[model samples]
Target: MTAETAVPAATSFAALHHRPGEPLLLPNAWDHASAAVLAARGFSAIGTTSLAVAAAVGLPDGEAATREHTLRLALTLGSEPYLLSVDAEDGFSDDPGEVAELAHQLWAVGAVGINLEDGLGPAALHAAKIAAVKAAVPGLFVNARTDTYWLGDGDGDGDAKDTLRRLDAYRQAGADGVFVPGLTDPGRIAHVVRCVDAPLNVLYSPAGPAVPQLADLGVRRVSLGSLLYRRALGAALDAVADIAAGRVPGGTTPSYDEVRALERSVSARASANSTG
Candidate 1:
């Protein structure tokens, strides 16, 4: 609960992970409208979707091509009421210092956490990035992500040793949490949860375990990743098809005034310190 605690943001965000079973269900938002709506709906923390960030600019995802877009979006959402965690894919560079600088900039803009993915690259390099970020911004929660399952080139269940090794390294290097995006097996998940020293974050998969099941398996954070963006795209397609077939859209649509209110709610109360 954000503004719910009225405490230091990092403390509020870090506390969300220690609740034994009730994992923090972080929904990813793409733009101002999406983030605003999610915040209005009472999500204490919001994360940016890297996929949507790149796609919105007609660029590719996971190629380190969206750093500016990502930072610009973070600058836009950082001053909001809720805690913000960014999905900085691979930290947008190979050098540790660069990643750390990015973390510092994000922290300066009011981000409480950052997600750094390994992309199945060298585990040692990812660990270095994690360490550097923690050294630069001690208060910023670092959620170290490893893509062993996504790029393992084998069955998801068989990448246990590699996953454990990478995640453990990240933990030792000061990662506040570890994320495995493509992992969904209950036994494997519970296994990683048992092995990793830090909080375990698993990407929410529609065909895999639901929130309750994930909670039961001891997951501490569940990320939506790009699911919301993908679903929104699907909704747009469905709505257009319905209109063509002489049928109205089925999903809930916010009124124009209500949408406008989301913006005015923020702009109406400018900070007293703004010189302009």
Candidate 2:
């Protein structure tokens, strides 16, 4: 598949969440090259990072400001061979209908999944958004996110109760999965996994459990979130600093032709599809 050519995938994106001990490790991509390289390296599904998308356009993440930029990226990567899941902050609106419309547009452009964060907003409103997206595009996987942990909720009875409450509400609203980005405690993670009815999705934190540990705790999806994008930016700074100091960069860097080959591969597929 290319930007203009979509091929039916053998496995559904939803299925990637349920391999028992082998949880889906979704590396978030910021642009074509990031996504293409991940796909080339055997990741069957890729998600966009909201922070990267916002940064790319000089906007802020979680402000519902990157809607158009997000859509533009979906247009570019949706038709790729691997599954594409977009990080659409709060669905870019408070209106459930508007959120549903965004999901429809993403799906129409070939995205199979979308991530919608509640941003510590009203539970009812987020649930409504999830319900609306499901009603409008039943085939599109909706990973409903609650910011209870993301907003700095610590490990307490109150925090656990609130997190469970929001996750339950989102599940009832037809969310295929639920994400809690800041939850890291092994016991707490296991507690939520056993309690939440829907598939558990958690942000992969450096301080938190690894993929195997997350799988052991029953987390179905582990999202890298904006880690890769942030690391990429950090790497660029490191490389330039190294060159300025007369030292070679240590990280593996792709050659100019290698990057060009990625573009040509997509172009070749587009040409084949257009003229086939």
Candidate 3:
């Protein structure tokens, strides 16, 4: 379907729920093909990774240099047959209204959800942005993320209390979910789950608790942020290294036509569904 209709149709928090045993394993995609492939493989939702989005444009992550590329990818995959949740770093601006405007654009392109991180920005300010975005697009699922552990220590008791205060502010500001990327302590995760009224989202890590364990810990959403994208980059580097060393790249590589067919297949299906 066209982005316009597709967005409104799927735009709701209902898509964010995870069945008790079925934890949300959100795959991060860098481009349309990656997203399509994941969808074909039965992933119900796909997320855009800031690292991949930035690296794809030869920019640095957390620096907001890939806004156009990020939006372009959103426009490309947003109308795909699965849900899309964008990783908008600090909303690309400190102004809440500007952030809300970006959220509007994302929704216009068919994104049903958005992941807005504070990146350790002022808690009140981030809360304002969340509230503004929700006011502009009430159906958009706002996943408010605090980077206390990712970026700061919160000092001591003061910091910890501040973190909780920020999370509470985000929840009161209408976040459908809350995310703390660097938090891995099972006790802390459970405590945060108890603290937030909305669903709790955690970043899935190789060293962190397993999916089942996270679900058991009350994490409603677990995102594979930048893992797939980084792995793809690693594979590219490996292949290049092998070529430079006079060694063949040994991996299950897709034929050129197989790669091309993905675009054709997904586009055709999307078109047929759009017109049907």
Candidate 4:
């Protein structure tokens, strides 16, 4: 299986954003087992978590250190039975051409979407990356993310304005959708939806509105970015502490057989690909 075989999935993934009243719930996966389990659970799309990818490799996330890891993950999960998106933090470079080339590589490896964050950099620079990515891989859904709200002081008025301003620039640069994480206010979310012509994507926060609430706010996509990975890490620690303290760990742990099934599926896929 290759990117060419996954073209139909890219089209189907783009259509998921257009469904009325039911926004796409994209779960982020860190590796093959995680992604396979998520796909088996029926997630139509799965995104690679930069945090999990970096943490797994003992590297700092969002600092452009995981370019090779990100590409390898894309290659591994690209042919899975779900849409794949890579979180290329800051496009792994400040240069628009480099970002565009990354986008080309991601698309070549079977990722249908790429998440590019501005990291509070120059608005024009982020917009240029979006423009270049679109020009290079038009089929790759460019979810242009602005960290104004994520990285700003909690001043509602100023942050909202900055968010809209950056989103406007990215949208004009041909971004397929816009993401504003750390934005939890319902009224503010509605206002952002009204202001941006592109589909609105919000990061799901436990402290923020729920999925149904976001759908009511006119959001088209909800991403659980790094949340699942963080929770899994937390669960592992809790289980270890409970075992060390001689207490029964009480959590929903997957059965060993179930996990082995995931491994079996991966082996089966590899065998099929090798023989096909």
Candidate 5:
């Protein structure tokens, strides 16, 4: 579909957060093909992983280096069937207006949501960026992320206190949701849920609580941030090693036709939607 046809998807993606007991399981994609395959598999919403985007382009993540690449990917996947949310690491700038402009461009390209991280910076600055993005494009779901826990070098009590403080600032600044990535403890998760009025987004940890557990703890969004990308890389390496060792690689590898079918289905659906 054209970007115009994808405009209403923002509302649908916003509604996904309000479904109780079923947090939006947001699987992040790195590029057009990954997003299309996930959309074909029936994921209503897909997020872009900044790490994957950076790694794919041989750039380092979290350094505000992949702005152009991020925009390019957004332009490519903007019209897909699934709702698109971009993991814009720190919005690629410290200036609130610049970050808001980035949000504007993403929205214009048909992105429904944007994730902005504080990177443990000053909470006030991060809040200003959120406020700017909201003012620029209020329809975009701003998942305001605070890395206090993720980057904290303090005790649990101190980290929780700081995280709550940052989240409060973000909420006051008009964030649609708040995310604390490194938080894994059930008690801490429940505490944050109780304290925050907006939707609480938690990163899914393989060694931590599962989706069901996170749902039980009152998380509105469960994001698989970069895990799929990392796993894909790992699988590719393992397959190559197995081939060199003369052992059959064991994994659910999709056939070439299946992948091509995903591409064809996307094109067909876009054509049909555009015509309708």
Candidate 6:
């Protein structure tokens, strides 16, 4: 797939339905190089992190400042040999139509999936937005996320109820998936999974439940979110600190040629696809 290439009409957002216990492990990539490298590593699908995309452009995360950069990334990665899902935070505005337009553009650029969040907004409004996006791009996967856990509700019972209410509305509005970022308890995760009709997508945390445990708990998608990007930044800082102290970097550095070869590989693929 390319910016102008025609994609098959049958491939729609409904294709994101999980194959039972085999969940989709979606890795978040910030740029074309990062996305291409992950695709090369055999990931069947890739997701974008709004935090990474915002940080890369020096904008505040969750402030709706990187729509262009997000779209550019989608256009760049959608052609890769894998499905692409974008994390479009809060749909960039409260207007559902604008959000639907964004989904339309994503579909035009070959994106097959997208993740939208409510950020604790009214559940009915978010559900309407989900329905609008689905109406605009019927084949684009709409992973509706709620920030009840990430923020908080002061009481556990209240938080659970709010999260469940949002998930119910999202499912009714035709969302293909529903995500809860901070729910990691195996029992609680299982409870939510059983409550929703759509596949449950959980954020993968280093301190959270392992993949096998999550699988056992019935999670159908595991999103890495910004963990990899944060780790990459930490590694860069560590390497710089080591050099400043006159110490060699500890990690295995890729040979200069190997890194350069990635550029060539991407260029070759782009050229070949252009001609083919």
Best by TM-score: 4
**Which ranges of candidate 6 are over 4 A from the true structure?**
2-17, 153-155, 273-276
Q: Give a tens-digit lDDT track for model 5, residues 41-108.
A: 89999999999999998999999999999999998888766789999999999999999999999999
For model 5, what is the C-alpha lDDT against the true structure? 0.91
lDDT of 2 by residue, 100-130 (tens): 9999899888888999999888999999999
* Predicted candidate 3 versus true structure: per-residue lDDT over 1-276, tens digit per residue: 364575455543345564665567889999888887798889878889999888887899887777788889898888777888999888888889998999999988888888998878778899999999999988888889998878886345665676688899998999988888888878888888887787788898788899999999888889999999888878999999999999999876778998999868877877887798
Assess each prediction's global lDDT (C-alpha) against the native: 0.90, 0.89, 0.84, 0.91, 0.91, 0.85
TM-score order of candidates, top first: 4, 2, 1, 5, 6, 3
TM-score of each: 0.95, 0.95, 0.90, 0.96, 0.94, 0.92
Name every residue pair that clashes in candidate 3: 154-159
Candidate 2: regions farther than 4 A off: 1-11
Clashes of 3: 1
Cα lDDT of model 6 by residue, 1-276, tens digit: 644343442253344456677677889999877787787788878889999999987899888898999999998877777788899998897889999999999888878888999988798999999999989877678899999988775247788888898999999999989999988777778989888888999999878899988988889899999998998899899999999999999885768786788789778987987898
lDDT of 1 by residue, 53-96 (tens): 99999999999999999999988888888999999999999999
Of candidates 5 and 4, the better by TM-score = 4
Provide the RMSD of all predictions against the true structure, rounded to 1 decimal: 2.6, 2.2, 2.6, 1.3, 2.1, 2.3
Deviation from native of the Cα of residue 168 in model 1, angstroms? 0.8
Name the lDDT value of residue 161 in candidate 6: 83
Model 3 scores what on Cα lDDT?
0.84
Scored against the true structure, residue 63 in model 4 reaches a CA lDDT of: 94
Model 6: which ten-residue window has the lowest total lDDT?
4-13
Instruction: Give the clashing pairs for model 5.
Output: none
